[model samples]
Target: TAAAPPRIFPQAQHFVSKEFCQTEFGIVYPPVISVSSGELIEVETRDCFDGKIHPPPNENDNNEYNPAQALQQMKRAEFNPITGPIHVNGAAPGDILAVTLLDIRPKGVGVT
Candidate 1:
């Protein structure tokens, strides 16, 4: 008997490259784009989170400190916000984002 083959997902077609990883902010890099020569792509990125830290008032003023404030402060930060829905000058509906693969660099030993 023959062994079964691996499954290929339908949504995978959206990517030009089958081999790539998501950036820290979550943009998926396709293998084709990764290996392409002289190709530049603009990835919209934003601050990982809003800069906010709450420190209790100093006791030197005889003020009371509330540890419960940390939870309330957490909601103020935003996570992985995208900066744009930027429009390409010549891009129109039904136009495919064209890319060509020119290289594929392998990870070092013991690395993926």
Candidate 2:
């Protein structure tokens, strides 16, 4: 007799959601929210600034600038851009979507 086939597991789809976790000092690290076919979750992320603020390399900008203006500039570039809205093949409205966090890694917080 032939050997029995191994059990199969269903594959999960991923969706990239955005959240304004925080914005300080001209640096911004947007939140990364993920959703699968069965749940809602928040994924771990590194600081978007990566310690590149304070003495902005571009144009040698100083700290004297308005915080709001600097933040607006960051926003203009659409900082912390999200990945996607991946729709599962069979997902529909009112359907349960289970999003789970497989892993998370975050770095220093943005300093204004």
Clash totals for all candidate models: 1, 10
What is the per-residue lDDT of model 1 for residues 1-112, given as tens digits with 9 covering 90 to 100? Answer: 5543232333232223221223233224222233232334433222333222234567776766554554355553343444333334555579876655333343232200
- Model-by-model lDDT, in order? 0.37, 0.42
Work out the TM-score per prediction: 0.26, 0.35
Off by over 4 Å in 1: 1-44, 53-72, 98-112
lDDT per residue as tens, model 2, 1-112? 5553222222423233233333333314432443335553333232354223443344665546554556556643445443333444466768876655565543333455
Backbone clash tally for model 1? 1
Among all candidates shown, the one with the greatest lDDT: 2
